[model samples]
Each structure stands twice: as C-alpha cells, then as structure tokens.
Target: MRAPTTPLRPQPDSLWRAIAAPMSTGAPLARDIDVEVAIIGAGYSGLSAAYALQKRGVECTVLDANPIGWGASGRNGGVVSSKFRLSFPTIASTHGIDVAKRMHRLAHDGVRTVEAFVDEFKLERARFEHTGSLRCAHTERALASICAEADWVRTTLNDTSMSVQSRAEVEHETGSKGFVGGVLSADAGTILPLEYVRGIAAGLNARGVPIYEATPVIDMSREQDGRVLLTAPGGTVRAKQVIVATNAYSNLTEATASYHRELVPFRSAMIATAPLSPELDAQLMVNRRSYTETRRMMKWFRNVDGRMLFGGRDAFGKEGEPTGFDALQRAMVALFPQLKDVPVEFRWSGYVGMTFNALPHVGRSDDATTFCLGYNGAGVAMASLIGQHAAALALGEKPELALLAQDGLRPVPFHALRAPGVRLVAAWYQFLDAVGA
Candidate 1:
C-alpha cells in the first residue's frame, strides 16, 4: 500500500484528543490508489476490520475524520459484558434459533477477543479485570425475569454458566444498596475505552496494517470492475470491497442518512468522580466488578483509576446532550447517598445509534457493498467480534451466525415526531418502571 501524494488530517477540534493524550499518526496519502479493501470510520468497526484483514494478508486503508477512537468507541461506557439485552424469543423469532445462538456467542466472545488482544500485546491501556458484571433489579418481578432469562439461555442455548445472584448477594457485590436483587454475569469485565482503542490500533499498525487517522471517506462510488472508489479530501482509494463501519458519525457521511433513518442517535452521557477515598474504593465495589441497574433509564458504572465513573440516561434531545452532568451527578448521589458531596472530575457525552428492534444490522447492500453496524450502544466487545464476521462476509464467505443481516431498510415510524415518537416511549418506560405497570 503506497502513501497518497496528499493525506487526510484531523480537524482542528477533535474530541478525544481534547481530553486524552495524543496518538502518533503516519504521513497522509498523496494520490488516488486502490487496495484489497477500503473502510470508513476509525472507531471499533473500522479498526477491527483493518486488524482482521491485515492479519489475513489483505492490504487495506482506514480513514477517520478524527483520530482513532475519537468516536463512541473511545467515548462509550466501556462495559465489555456480552449479554444481548434483547430477549431470546424475539431474537430467535427474527433470525431463527441456529443463527441466534451463533450471534449470541459472537456477542459474548467479543469480550474474549479484547482479552486476547490485551494478553497478546501486553499493553497497559488494556487494563481489563474480569470481576464479572451485575445487573441490579428494583423489583421481584424484574428479578424473576432475570432468573427466567438466565435459565432459558442456559437451557436452550446450552450455556450453563448463566446463573442468578440473590438480592443479598447483589447488595453485597455492587456496594449499591438500593436494589432488591440483581443478575450476576460470571464472565464479564471492564476497560478504559481510549486505552483499549490505543492498544489495538498500535498493535495492528505495528503488524503492518495501514491505519490512517484524520482521514475521512467523503463519498464512495462503484467501479466498472466491481471495486469501490472511496473519496477523501486528500485522495481516493479503490478496493475490491468496502465496509461501512461508521456507527454514529456515519450520520455525517452522505450515504449514511438513508441507512440511519431507523437508527436514532441517542446521547449516552457519563460522569466520573474525583478518585474515591481508599476507604470508599474498598467498600464501594465488588471485586472491582462493573454494573448496570435495572432502571428504564439505567445507571451503569465501574471502577477506573480509583474513580467511580458512572454513565446512564438518554440525553432528552440535543440540548440535553450538552448538559447532562448535573442530572447524572445527582443521580449518582441519590443511588449511593454516601457519596453526596463528591466532586465529579470529568463529564462527557456522545451519541450511540439505535434501532427500534434493538438489533444491529449486518448484511450486503443493494450496491454490493457490505455493512456491519448498529450495535445499539454495546460496541466495546461486540464491534470487534462483528467486524471479524463482516470481513468474512466481504470476502464472500457465508457467516455462521444468524443475525438480522437481510432486514428491511424502513425508517423508524414518526422520526420527524421524535419528541413525540421516542420521548413518549421513554416516558412510558419510566412510568412503567415507577408504578410497576
């Protein structure tokens, strides 16, 4: 892969770089060229594609409008738990039992892939500890639902490790005493988002994958010979195949508007407290395990660098996205009243693409281009795993997993009425959770 005569560079104001340290970048591409494949968006999906393809001896170029991990892959909750939040009956009904099971493994094992990379590369940024995750519940019915789901997965899916944690155990485990009970994931873990991205990008680049930060694929067209032509400001790239890995930022890409109509951009916000007192850390977490409470507007968090970093809530709208710190901080205190006066050191929010069905779409498009996207907000481990499968599909290999690969392209009903559309749905959920309806 030759460098272009000119290369794409990052914009003046990149988000991740604003808060985190800088990433080392290579020289820009200078001219139009072609490769085996071309990918847009440098987040998990794009980087994962580059990593997997490079390992397979495929020469590919990756472009991102900002630095690697600058998007949600760098800004998400960083919970690598692999439980598919959607119910089994729904998944099995849509994609069939066989396909659902494979996708299930793909989801859970996404975390394993991350663990393997961290182990192989020995990067400090991938500081993952597997204490397992806890899903705390507020009601007996919710707890029963959790147990029933776990039993169903273990019995039908042949995953026996899935089990239920008693209410007493959950209260002991998460240090959050507000819940009556919870579900414990014996196989889950957590990581620092930016750190994980850096480690993977660095490891892949070291192994000869051409990972380009600050390059944006402005538009893509098809060639007569069946290759894809991806146009960036610096130059163009032609490839035998292309993968649309832009999850949220894909909205900014011209082709993505149609793809994202059913996919709503939700603002997931988070706040991190000043380092907890040594005493607080010991009493606050269960083996440093990560957790997400059973709220309609759920609260999820884990330990990071001595701070209790927690995130939850759909930013009511664009305006809410910009100022979620106060609400989240107050929510944190309300849940764990002991930390009432703690100062939250950092706060940030980014959008996650969601589908009404809550299932991610991965399939071939009308233009013969392949797509692997819409993991809802659970991209940490799932993105890497799905990208591998998507790359396999791009190579024309049949995927063994049963996913919503060939679904319709219909927009979510009432998108123009989101305040009435989604906001009402959210309100209903909150009401149901509150009144036990």
Candidate 2:
C-alpha cells in the first residue's frame, strides 16, 4: 500500500562492522536486464542461492535494499547451531520420527555446508571456529529435559558428538554456576557471520552474478510469457524465475504482501563488552564455547575475539529503549558475577522472523516465485541450506532435503495485532521461565 523505505543501516560501532574487512561496492541497477533468475535480498539466503545457482551454470542477479549482510546475517550472535528453533522431540511428535530424522540430518548437513564454504573459498577472515556449543539449563527442571534430549540425540540420531553435562561439569566448563546443567554438541560452533556472508557475496561476484546494492524491488508483475518482471528504483529485471529471500527485512510489495504477512518480525538485541582481561576471560568462559540457556525467552553468549558478546529477547522494548540492554547486562552479571563492572562497548538490535509454526519454510509462493525464509532466529545454518534449496527449486530441480517442504508459510492469526500479541507472548514465556513452570 505504501512505498518501502530504505532498510536501516548497521550501527557504525557494531562489532561486525568494526572488524569487517573492506567490502567492494556494487553499483545500483541502472537499466533493464533479463536473467534466468532474480534474487531479492543479499543476505545469507539470497547470496547463498546466487552462489549455488552460479555453480549450476544458471544466470541470476541479486538485489538488496542495503549492502549485503546488513540484516541479522551480520548482526547475529554467530552461533552456527545445526538445530531448528523447535525442539527435536517436538518436531518428532508433530511430524513423525522419519521426518524428524530427515530434518536432523539436514541440519547437520547445514553446518557442514558452512564448513565447506569456508574451506573451499578460503574465507580466512571469517574466523570460523569449531569450538562447539552448549545449551545450558537455566533451571533444575530444564536440566532434566536437556539431559533427555541429549540422550535422544545420541541414541536415536546416532550422534556421538553430543553429550549431557552434569551440573558440576557445566559449571566447570562454563565457569558459571548459574546453569544447572547443559548439553554439549561438539559438531556445533561459531563463525564471524558477517565475514562468512561477505565471503559468499564476494565469491558470487567473482562468478559474475551482478549484485545491485541499494536496489529494492518495488513491485513485481507477471509477463505474458510467464516471466516475472521486477521493478526496482533504478531499473527493472525480467526473470524467468524469482526468489524472495528478504527474510525479516522483507518489504511489503504487492508480490510479497501475502507471504510477508506470514512472518512476524521481532527485534533481537545484543551487547558486546569491552575486551575482557585474560584472567577474567579464563575465569568466565573457561572453554570459550558458544552457549544459550534452555528458556523460552533465552539468552545466548560467546567469547568472540577476546570480548563477551551476548543477546536476548527484545520484545518488551522498542529500538531506542534501554530495557532490553539492561536485562541483558543483568543476566550477564548474574551468570558471571565478576563481569558486573565490565564495560559494554556496543549495543544494537536486529529483527528476527518468527513463523506461526516456529519452523523455516522454502517453497513456491506462486508458479513463478519461490521463497526461503522464517528461520525463527536459527538463521545462520538454516538460511544457507534453505538458500541452496531455493536455488535448486528455481532451476526446476527437487530439493534434496525434505525439511523445507513441510509446513509451508501460513499467516499468523490477527496479523495486524502481531506486535501486541508477541509482546504478550514474550511476557508469558518470561513468567514461565522465571517460575520454572
């Protein structure tokens, strides 16, 4: 109904931007062009799809409202977890064990996909690390579930790399007594997410895929010959196929209005501490592993380049409000009492797409348009894998993974009231988590 404004720019002091390598610039779309595929959004999903398409000798062009990786792809916590937003048992119960197993395997492969990309492209700046991840139990009741899930993963999935830690073990490994216990997954790890996405963009650029920055697709129309005509600010693209990969930052164009309504975007905020002293680092994060608590409204943190970067829910606070940051700081101090006096160097926020079913989707929105989005905060690994799948679908090939084919996008009920509804849901979850209900 209204023109889409330019996406917000990344904060100048964001840790990712501060450490990011200089990026090459791409000119905006200057004139009309024709291609086999046109990809909107240059984040991980779109860039990954473009890369995959190029590998298959397909012609595709990528367009972004902002520079590549300007969204959650760059501002995220960098936890390369090979898991869905929903729990494994929940997925199994809902989708059957066979489908659940397939989904698990797909997630595992998603992690490997990132590993392969880093290695094949020699993304030295990505600073990819295989340090593993910990899912800490915030309460004693959560510890039981954590242990049970770890056992299920080991026995059912035959994943020997995952194990449940006892309370003492968790405290010893994390140097924090706040966690009752945890599940350690050695296959999971972390990476410089921004660097990884930028690396993919660079690789795609090298392969001759024109990436148009500051080029927002304003509208899309179907041509008589079944092509999709995408109109941007500077020019137009007539493509045989279109892939909508905008995710949380999706604009409400006529082409994407219905699908965009299916996604509920909530702000996820983070704070990075000034470099911790080596002794403090050792005292706090003994294993330097990425970690997230087992709470519905969760907190995630990791030791990144000698600093502690942490994030959590921001549903209760607006963009400029300090409520979210204050809560995060308190949580950080509660976990590591020694960090109560630590200085926070950076604070920022980004939108994460939440789906009604709490699972990411990838499929055809229409005969000529395909999409991959709604990661529900687990975008790092899932987005990359889904992007590749979207590329396959674009080329008229079946996706190798069946996870994307399940639970296609459905608009949330009372979509117009989503903001207040999400805030209420967040408050309820917080209360439940607080009371260990």
Candidate 3:
C-alpha cells in the first residue's frame, strides 16, 4: 500500500466544495432594512426556515459569515440517518418510553421531510439516493446490543423498516469482515450535502428571500417596540423576530454569548479517495449504503459516485492534523483491504455542536429571539425539522418537536473550561474504544 508521502495540510477545501457548483454570491446586507424575521446563519437550518416562512407569507432575511454551505451542512458525511447521538434505550431510560417513541417518530419525520424537499424541489443535482444505512457493530457485545435495539425499534416503535443482519449477512452486504453484525434502516439514505444546501438556497432565492453572504451579525439587541435589531458589517436589520441557526459556527456576540455556553464545538474530519476503479468499487461498498460503527468514537463511511468518503473522530484536539488523515486512511484500509493503495484526493474538517444533554435543543433564548441547534453531528435531517420548528416558534406557533422545547437549553457546567474538558473526555473515549469497553 502506498502511504502518504507528506503531512496533509489543514486546508478548508472539501470534496463537496469541489463537486458542487458554486452558489451565486448574493450581495451582502448593504443597507438597513426591516423584515418580519431575520435569520442568522445561512446553512440548512436557516434556509429551511426561510423556505417555511416564505410559504407562510412571512418576510425573512438570512445572514451568514461565509458563503452558504460553508459550515457543517456542507462538510458532513451526508449519511442522512434518522438516529441521534444517543441510543433509543438511553433516551427511553432518561425520558419515558412514550417520549422516546415520539422522538423516534420525529426523527423519522425529519428524514421524510428531507426526502420531500428533494422530490418536490427536483434536487437531482444533489445526487439524492434512497439507499439505506447500516449501523455495524465493532464488537460481539455491541452486536448483541444492536440486535436488542433492532427488536426494540420493531416492537416498541412499530418500525418494520429496520432489520438486524448477522455477521455473514453484513459481510456480504458491505464486503468487509470487520463488523460482527449490523442493523439496516431502509428509511435512511445519502445525498450530496453541499448540493442539497445550495439547492435549498436556490429555492429561497427564487422566493425573494434576501440571503446576505459574508455578512455576520456582529451585535443583536431588542428595541422598545418589541423588535430585534441585528447589526452587521454593512448595515443592520430590524425585524419583529430573529432565529439563530448558526449551529457549530456560532459566534459569541453580546446576544449570543450565552448560547456558546450551551453547546461545545467539536471538530470532525473527513477524507475521500479518488474515484475507485470499477472492479474495486464493485468489490467494496457495492451496496452503496451509508455505514457507521457502534463505537463511542464511531466511524462513518459511504460510497459517492464510485469514490469512498470516510470520516470519524480522527482528531480529538481543537485543530485537525495530518495524523488524523492517516488514521482515517488506516481505518478505510482495515475495512476494505482492496483499497489499501487507493489515492486519497480530499481531506477536510468541520465543527459539530454538541449539547450537554445529547439531544438537539430548540427554544426561545428570549421573547422575539428563537434558536435551534446542537445536533450532535446528526444535523442533516434533524436540522431541517428543527429549523422549520424554529421559524414556527418565531411566528408564534408551537413547534412540533415538544421534547426539544421541554428539555430547553441548559449551559454546560464549567463552560469556560469546555475546550480542555472536551479534549480530556475525547481522550477517555479513545481509551475506552481502544480497550474495547
């Protein structure tokens, strides 16, 4: 196998960025304006909320620090799985069986919403695929737990679309012998994440929503007339309500500094190999299903246009290093030996917002200021749902995801030490993963 000759530079270039067409660089917020709603962050969440609000005849403006799809929405693995970071059993134990079931339904609904968006909007450029997902087990005990979880999903949740696969079956499906067993969810799938977000932006643009790229809201405050004032580099937006959909890239302004304490931004890196040969592609990941392991620091991979895209907890520190790319390449080789010498063409990383509790949070930071974020790396599907719910909340409507609203946003303990604490916790998790705990 040919190894990396030099250290990989930590560049912001991503495979998605190369493949997806550039979105139109809409003008920045050039002048002060008043709208019914102003959205911060032009990612999937912001665009989805804008679409929803447009459909409801609500005027909204979207502001972003960078171009659309420049955040996690464009840099994710694009698995689009309905599962959250925490397991169903853990959710049931913490909340209740009914709440867990509700959450599951909500996640499934979120997946369907993405499907609907792709279909209704004709997002063929997004490479939307209905291929299912495989949750593989790295250990025998984990396989048993996966089996139990599958059973619970079937009986408790009445979800007949999910099934467990034995080691032999999983091996046949994935062409990899590393996993002991797996669970398949037919509802899950994959898409070109950057294309998907850009497609949404296009729809919003068509609907006359002003999306101000490279315009960050430097400050936000309330007016005496119960309106919100958002100050940007070029101008300001005065709106009746505001939604913060910045997710992991949230900047700490006077109005949003408290939100920084509620979530931790953890960097996740990804690597993609050059397009594989037809023979190699047919031998590895022939099913074209998104796959991830059951490890605490898990690995996620999928086949995109005959190329292998793999990602995981490659870097535990704040910044990504060349060692992280080496780790991911090693992981890919371990799973599919036939690609041991495959040339890697892309390496990138992005941050994911993780909350104190493992669940995504959506609520009003204060009256006229609503926020929805903290996906724990499962933002593709849930972000769309949460974003729409956030828009609805801003419009004085009750959001459908009640659990997120009920849980509310609680700042992590010792918010100032989150960076060091996250590193220590990552180290502990890595130790546990290495020890097979």
Candidate 4:
C-alpha cells in the first residue's frame, strides 16, 4: 500500500466537522496569565471541566493543541449511549453489586448531563435525540449475553427501560437480519457529537471562560507554594489548580507523559454514506436509534439526517493515517448490502483511551494537578461527566462516583510495549470473534 505523501491533517476530514455549526475557538494564549484553574484540552472533558469551574465562580482557561473538538470528541460516530465497555456482571464480580448499581446510575447520569447541557444552552444545532440505543447480537453466545444483561438491568437495577428483543424483532427494528437478537435501553440516545462539544465551548465563552486553540502545553511543573505552572510556546499559565483532560492525545507532549503512560490508546475508524433515499432511511434504522453489534471488536452505526454513520475498531498501517476505510465499508456492506452502492462521503479515525481496568479513572495526580480519562470508547457522555468530577476534585470536593473517587492514575506495566501489545490483543479478539470462540 502506498502511504499518503502528506502527514495526516491536524484534524482529519469528518462528517461532524463538515456539517457542524460554526463556532470560534478564540486565539491562542500569547502572554503569561494567572487563573484559579487551567484546563489542558479543548475536547469534551476539558471543556466540561471549564464549564463546571466557571459555574462555581472560579476563573479558568482552556488550552488545546488544535482547533476545538479536534480529537475523538469531534471524530466519534455520534452515539450518545451511556454503556461502558464492561458489562454489569463483570463490574459486580469485581466490585460489590451495590457498587455496580452506582456505576450503572453514574453511566445514566452521564447521558442526562449531556441533555442538561443542551437544555441549558439551548443547543438545537447539537441535534440531540433521546431515541434510545439497541445492541444487536452477532452470534448465539452474544445473544445469550445480551439477554442476561437485559435481565440484570431490569430485575437487579429495577430499570424497566431495558428489554430483550427476539431475532425477528431486531430485524423489524433495524431492517437488518445480520443480527441474531438484541437488547434495547431507553436510557441511551444519539447526538451530533462535534456540535455538542462545540456548543459547550460557545456557552463557556459567553460565560467568561476563554478557550485557546492551537496552544499546547509543552511543559508542566509545580511551584514551591503548591501552584501548578504550565508552559506553552507563546505564554505560560500559573494556576492554583490544573486539570489534564487530553485523553488519548496526552502522549503528544512530555508535560502529559505521566497521564499518557496510564492509557492504551486505540484507533477507531469510521465512514459516513451520502444521504440515503427516504425509502432506504425508512428501511434502515426505522426508529433512528444508535445501533451496535455484540462482538469483541464491535461495529456501531446510526441514522443521522437520513445518512448512515458507521464506525468500528478497525485501523491499518501507520498511526494518524486514514487507512481503514475499505475495511469499514466492507463491514457495513456485510451488514446492509443495500448500502453497498451508497457513496461514502467521509472517512476518518481517532484514538480512544483504554485502561487496564476497563473503567474510566478520575482523581488527583498531585495536590495541584487532577486528571480524568481512559473512557475506552465511551468518551462522549462519560467524558462530559468525568470532566465535572475532575473539576470537583480540583476544588477539594469529593467525586460523586465512588469508584473514580478512590482511583488514581494507574500506569500500564511496560508502557513502551503498548503498541505491539494492543495489536496482539486486537488480533486475538478478532480471531476469537471469527471462530465464535
């Protein structure tokens, strides 16, 4: 395969970025300044933290290495589901059942938090839809797991919003017979992710929190008096407290190296088809719910404005390059052959931060520095919530989620080998998925 002559664009071409409403990200920081709190990322978590801090009447500034929503926050498939990579049973087995309940509730709260932001800011352009989410089973084993999960959600959590669906029901709902069966959760939904995050930034700007794009924090240090100093190319910020919310892009700078070591950043590729015909839209995703198949390396898609937005954990060749569009297209065609002739208008990829624990981590790295990341592909809703948790932690308030409140940055063992390790694990999962293991 021939590599592109040019390196990847700072922010690759994406469906969301192309159609999102315009919003200014402000000029980069160009002079020394002091603030109560400083945030180092313009993505969902950092922006959310800035919003929470400003609400508390604390002065804060957000800095980013690129334009606003340039990371996974802008590149995701716009699925606003509050589900985590781990299942309820796994969480209950690790923590107690009560803890598992709290985690589940917290996940739901994440979804509500985004909705609250939309209502507060009147972000109609965000195009949020509370139409719920459907998880289809790709195999018999997966079908059993989906049914068990739906049962746990209904009986144990007392959440009547979740239900299991038969294969025929799944086909009728999704217009695709590729799935064996499925589970539906009314607590989930969909949104224009880039629009949502950018809307948050706009609201923050109006509320006096300045977000500086193209301003990367290159170095960080602690003062003798417990204040944190972040040095950027054009200026330096001395803040009483700092929240690092860079997520998978944390490794781009030595300043966030410690946080980077804790995560296994995996690339997720996506594709979007040109607007589907009314008939095609009606046939596929009739209810406009976020849809995913139950596979170790899963595929997710949804209907957005009569278009099919599809994505998966498939990437090839070099990092930051657009090399997996064909694979994603093949997957989409396999599921919906009718779409095989549809024109693909967008192809992009972004990193998702994964942790060894398979759960997001939030806590202080030091007295003046706090961090929240490792969403494992659930960043849209979870990041928005955890950003607030990181802000509360910086302000000396306890985080609402007990699991995160007790957790700190746990570095991966032998972090240098993450690339090869991730590849090996991904190949193993793909093989298992292929053979129905």
Candidate 5:
C-alpha cells in the first residue's frame, strides 16, 4: 500500500484513502474527442463499464469530477456479501420463484465478478479476504427473519453454505453479546475498498481506456446526426452512446438530473479505531468474520488489518465535515465493552443511492444513453455487475440477468423532500427497532 496524494477537489479523509495504493489521476479531457461510448463517473460502475467496453474492443473514455475512488466506491465498507437489501424469500413472494432464483444467481455472480477482477488484475494489496460475514439479529423478530433467510437459502436456493446460530453461538462468534442470534454466509468476504477500486482504475489504464479525472459533464444533448454530445468543463465528448454511472453524485450535473431523481441519496458513516493488540483482536472478532446487524437502521463492523471498523448512518456534519464520531464510538463500546478505551483514529462518510425498490437498476434513458446505479449500500459487488450489464445493454446485447434491464426508471416520489423524509423514516425505524418490531 502507498500513501494517498491530494486530488483536485478535497475528498473525504477516509481510512481507505489513507492506506490505498497509488494510482494516477489521469489528466482532464482538454479537447474535443469522439468515442464509441462515453462514461461519466470514476467509481466502480463507471470503471467496470470502461473495462467491459475495452475488452469488447470498443472505444470508450471515463470522466469524473474528482479523482479515481473519490466517491462511495473508495469510501464504502468493503463487505462483498452476495445478498441484496431485500431478502430472497420476500423477492420470491413478490416476484415469481424463477425471477427470485435468477436474482439470487445474479447476486452470487456479482461476488464472482469482483473476485475475478481481483485475481485477474493481481490486486494483492486490496487484501481480498474470504473469511465470510455474519448477520446478527438485534431483536427476536430480526432473528426470525434471519432464520427464514437461512431456511430459504438451504431449501429453496438449494445452498447449504449458511448456518443459523443461537444467542450463545452468536456471542461465541462475535465477542459481543448485543446480538440475539445470527446467520453466517460462507460466500461473503471483505476487501480494502479504495485499493480495489484504484486497482481497477489501474487495470483500465493498462487496457488503454482513458479515465479523465476532474472533468465533470455539465450538460448533455442529442445531435441531429443521432450521436450524443456531452459538454464537459474542459472539452466536449461526442459518442455513439453514453453511460451515466454517477449514482449518489448524479445530482452534480444537469445531464443526470433525471437519474438523480430516481434515487434518494443518504449519507453513511464509519469510524476506525487504532490497531488493536493481537490478543484483543482475536478475542473481539473470532475468525475475523465481517459482522452486521439485522436492524432497519443497520450497523456493521469488522477487523481490518488489526483495526476495528464500525459503521452506521447519518455521519455527515456541517460544512461537509463528518459527524457522529462520538455516537459511533459509543455504539462500538456498547457492542464490545473491551473497546471502551480504544481511541477512534478515523471518521468519514459517503453517500449511497437508494432506490424505491431497494434493488439496483440497469436501464437506458434513450436509445443512446445507458445507466446502472442505486446499489442501496451494496455497491462493491452489485455495482460491478450492474456496470457490466450496462455495458452489454449499451452494446445492444441482452444482459444475462434480463430482469434488471429496463427501458427507464421511475422517479422517486416527492424527491425534493427526501432529506427530511429520510430523517423521519430513520427515526421511526430506530423506534421500531427499540421495540423489537
């Protein structure tokens, strides 16, 4: 790993950035250019799309307002769990059993996609750990849900890689006794998020796919010649097709205003404690399994390189600064009293794009514009898969998982009031969680 250098715009002072390996922040587009496909955003989705396009021998370039890994891709918790925000049984009941099974397969394929990238690109510093993840229940209702999920995974999905645990088993697995019960999925894992994304950017550059940093697409319009014209601050991009992969930052440009309306952006925060002693580390996170809560207002933690990383919601402070360090520390201490004195060394937050369906979307705005976004806090795997599907859609090819492909997305209702609405929903969820609802 290498020390992070400064970028054009100030980015979150995240622990991932601090320890990420170095990669070039390619120069901004400074002149008119034409390409087969143009991508906006330098995060996982954009870079992955560029890679797919490049592999297919298609001409493409990536544009971002900031440097590579400047968004949620670099800042998010690197849990590579093969599951969505909604459970499989719920999807099975809502959608048909076939569609639910396909969705489940897609989720597993997403994990493989990321693993393949790491292995194919030799991203050793990304530290891809296949230690698996644990989903702990905060309430008995949550425990019941976990049990249902486990049963569904085994019976319906015909997979026995997961096991349900009792409260004593949960306490044994995680050093904390806060959880009632839990389920462990052996397919889940962890990585250094910034390192992984930066490694992807490196691989893309090696493939000759130009990634222009600090180049924002201000406006987009269609040309009479049936091509798409993108107006960037430094130059213009004329492309046969365009891919908008900006996700939560879609609101930054007028070109993606409609895409922004399809998602409710929420700030997610995380804190990291200084490295723990070998004894304490072993005692806290036995087997080094990634841990998460089943509460609506979710919480997650894991030991990364001897440091304890705890995360939850509402981390943004005034003036773009990160808040809730104290609250996060208190929560962490509450979970594991042994960490009461473990000083927090880092605090940061990033925005996640939430869809009304609580699932990702891959679709086209027009015949010439393709987009894939709204990972609902599971972007590490889902974003990569969606990006690949977005590329296939742009190429006029059917995506393997056809359920995700759509003509367009419906806008979130009352989009302007989402901020306050999110606060209210979060408060209600917290209240219900307190009462074990």
Candidate 6:
C-alpha cells in the first residue's frame, strides 16, 4: 500500500505582477531522464542554476509546479537588495564578519547581474533600473537607529550609502512632503518581474537546459546508492543530485523539516494606479528610487511608467484576497496625503517565504543527495546566485558552498505553527496602527 504524498504548501498568487495579458508557457517533462542535477521550482533560483549548470556543461532539468516566474519571483516588488533580511549585527554575531561580508556582496551584485543580463540578452521584459533607494524613518525615534546603522557600515563595513536625507531632501525627492530624514543608497532599483524571469528562462533554454512546467515533484525517496526518486504525477525522475529552490510553493520535506518553521509564507499586497501625470512622478520621486519605511509594519513604494507602485503586508487576515481597489486607493491617499483623488489601475497580492531571521539559507544537505532552500524574503539576486552555489557544490566543483558544510540552511523549530505566530505579530502591529502608536 502507498501512502498519500504530502501536500506542498501553496505558492503565492500573482496579483499585481499579473501579466497585462496571458503570456507564453513552455513544454512539460514527458519521460524520466537521468541527469547530473535536478532542480525543483523555477523562479530565479531554478533558472539561475540552469544557466550556471549549463555553463559548466552539466545536465540539469528544472521542474516547476507551474511555469517559470509563476511563483513569487514574477509576483514580488522588483526591488532587490542583500540588506540583511535580519539586521547585519545579528549576522555578524552568528556567521562572523567574513561570512557576513560575503552575504552583503552576494546581494549587492544581484543588481549588476540583472543589468548585465539585460544588456547581454537584450531582454525587453526587464526594466533594469539603478534609481537608488531611500530607507526612510517614519518616526523620530527610529531616526537614531538608521544613523547608527549607517555609522556602523561606514566605520566598520566601509560602506558609504548612509548619507543623511534632511526633511527637504525627502520632500524634494519623493514629492511626498513630510518626514524627518532618511538614507539614500545607489545600490538598488526596480524591474518588470516577469520580463526578468522570461529572459532568464529563454537564455537558459537557448543554452540547451530543459525547463518543464506543470510538473511537480510529488514525492521523493532515497535509493540505496544515495540517488533520489522524484515522483511527479506523470512519472518518476532519478537523479544523482537535486537542488530544491522552491520557496513558498515548495514541497515541505523531512529534509526541509525545520526550514518550514523558520520561514513565514505570508501574503503582501500591491496596487498601481493608472499611470499618473508625468509631473506627478517628478513631484513624487526624484529618480524612481525605491522608498521603504523604518516602521515594523512598513510600506514601500517605487515609481514606474508614471505610476506609483505601493506594497504593504497588512492587507487582511488569512486566505489572502486583494482588498478592492477602492480600499487600496484610500490607503495610498493616507500615506501620501496628496493622492487621495488618484486612481489605481492594477492591484495584486502574493505570498513571500520569509525566514525568521529574514536572511537567506543556502548550502547542500546530507538529508538529500544535494539540496538547498529557504530564501526568507530576499530572493531576487541571492536566490538566483544560490542555483550557482547549489549546482556547483553538488557537482563537487565548489565544496565550500555545500549545504551540509559551514553556513548551511537551518530549519525553524515549528513551522506548522508559523501562521499562528505570524498572526500574533500581525495582530500587535495592527493594534499599533489602530492607535497611532
């Protein structure tokens, strides 16, 4: 008798990141074939691994429950950064300064990689932007924290993007008058999420790496020879090494047991108004710089095509439905105080797999032949690079990047309780916002 395969937690929906129209999806994996590596989940991580593995002349098959970029990669706000998902000090305390530095560099380089990809491939879907970003403080008390953070980066990390943003700079730049000040970093920007995915997929396919959609790895069992049996609805694939890059929509595993606890797959919402007047943008943003707040329950915004895209996590309770456009418009008005009359053209929501520490978990594991998962919230670039790390580590080409080695992914203690924990945290913030505390 065969027991039922475990249910993989559902991935987030592509609300705002939805295509203006239906896009093209590729073929499926028909028959099982032996390969040097098998990667699950076709977001940035999966696609990146395909590119890297192909470059090294390795046979790799990318499997996705849906299509590439169909997950959070295509649905997320396009801002990319390696800014500690948790605070940097915490990472230094845990992974030490050297590893922490490497993490920061990995994230910062995602910007360059995307830009380079755009230039080399000439992909029209990705809108490569270097509009810089403003990490602003919503409260006076919070100002000191940013200042300390900036000082630490400069004196210790030798980083220098922590310049002060006087109230005038904030007012003049964002055009959303008000606020004490903030820091402007030139190390980030926005892009059309889907374009980024399609471009990467197309490039990988051109290089002969096969990517299959509608193929979910249903169940897996380890063979005596340490090979893995990945059973999908159609058939089973046997592979020597596997890399699991499936975040929110991934199969939870005995191998990924604790990671489920460490990561929180919660829904966040974003709505873009019909392109506002071009003047509205010159007034709203200096150079399309990404803007996020210092509050615990923060809102982030970016400018695109004369439209303002605002994202926030406090949309509603469970089930993750997009609040009607009217509600979102009202929230935007409250934030800008000037957009009360503006109209929104698109609204969408999706789930992001957030690690408790908010940083990414990389490395190979002993539980699986070779596997790595959990990106917390920062996946744009880090996740992309992980494919390179995972495949490389799996092929014995880069032993340092193995998940079973130093700096491997750690599972959270009780992921089954994550929704409850997230609810408790969300409840407190919801209360704080209610009282203006």
Over 4 Å off, model 4: 1-10
How high is the lDDT of residue 126 in model 6? 79
Local distance difference test, each candidate: 0.74, 0.83, 0.83, 0.87, 0.86, 0.69
Q: How well is each residue in 1-437 modelled by candidate 4, as lDDT tens digits? A: 22112222356678887887665546777888999999999999999999899989999999887888888898888888777888877788889899889988889989989999999998899899999999999998988988888888778888888888899999988888899989898888899988888899999988889888878888899888888899887788999999999999998778898999989888899889999998999899998899988888889999887888899986855555767788889989999999989999988888889988888888888888989889999888899888998999999998677566635667899999988888899899999988987
Candidate 5 has which clashing residue pairs, if any?
none
The model with the greater lDDT, 3 or 6, is 3
- Tens-digit per-residue lDDT, 1-437, candidate 3: 22212221222688898887755566667788999999998888988899889989999999887778778898899988887777788799888998898889888888988988898778899887779999999999898888898898888888888898999988887888999989998888898898899898887787788898777777898889989999877788999999998887775345566666678888788999999998878877778889988888888898888899999864655544565778878888988887888899999888888887788899987778888889999999999888998999989898678468834457888888877887898889888878888
Error of 1 at 308 (Å): 1.0
Clashing residue pairs, candidate 4?
none
The alpha-carbon root-mean-square deviation between model 6 and the true structure, to one decimal in Å, is 4.0
| Residue range with the least summed lDDT across 10 consecutive positions in model 1 | 8-17
- List, residue by residue over 1-437, the lDDT tens digit for candidate 6: 23323233333434334542355667556666777788887888888777778888888888876767777788777876646556655666787887757656666666666776778678766777777778877666677777777777677787786577877888787776546788877787777787787788888888788887777776767878888878776656788888877777663334334334446777677788777776676688766778887767677888777788888776655435545335556656876876776777767776677765565566655545455455655567666666677777777765333221335456666667777878799889867755546
Cα lDDT tens digits for candidate 2, 180-298: 88989898888988899989888878778899887778889999999999998778899999999988777435556666677888888889999999898877667878899988888
Pick out the ten consecutive residues of candidate 3 with the lowest summed lDDT: 1-10
TM-score of each: 0.90, 0.95, 0.94, 0.96, 0.96, 0.87
* C-alpha RMSD for every candidate: 3.3, 2.6, 5.9, 4.1, 3.4, 4.0
Question: For residues 1-437, could you state the per-residue lDDT of candidate 5 as single tens digits?
Answer: 22223237756787887887655557888888999999999999999899889989999999998988888998998999898888888888988788888998998888898899999899899988888889999888888978888998799989887898899988988899899999999888998999998899998888889998888888899999999999877788999999999999898778788899989888888999999988888887787888999878888999888899999875544325646667778888988999988889988888899988888888998899998989999999888878988998999998875356566878999999988888888888878877888
| Candidate no. 3 TM-score | 0.94
lDDT of 5: 0.86
For residues 1-437, could you state the per-residue lDDT of candidate 1 as single tens digits?
44443344342232233445566665455568878887777777878877778878888877776677777888877788786658775677876898778777777788887887788777565567777888888788888888887887888898775678887787777677788887777778887678788788888878877766656676778888877888776777888888878876676667555566657767788888887888788778757888888777788988776778889865566622456678788778877886887787777777787877787777777545667777877878888777877787788887654655654466778666745566677778878877964
Task: State model 6's lDDT.
Answer: 0.69
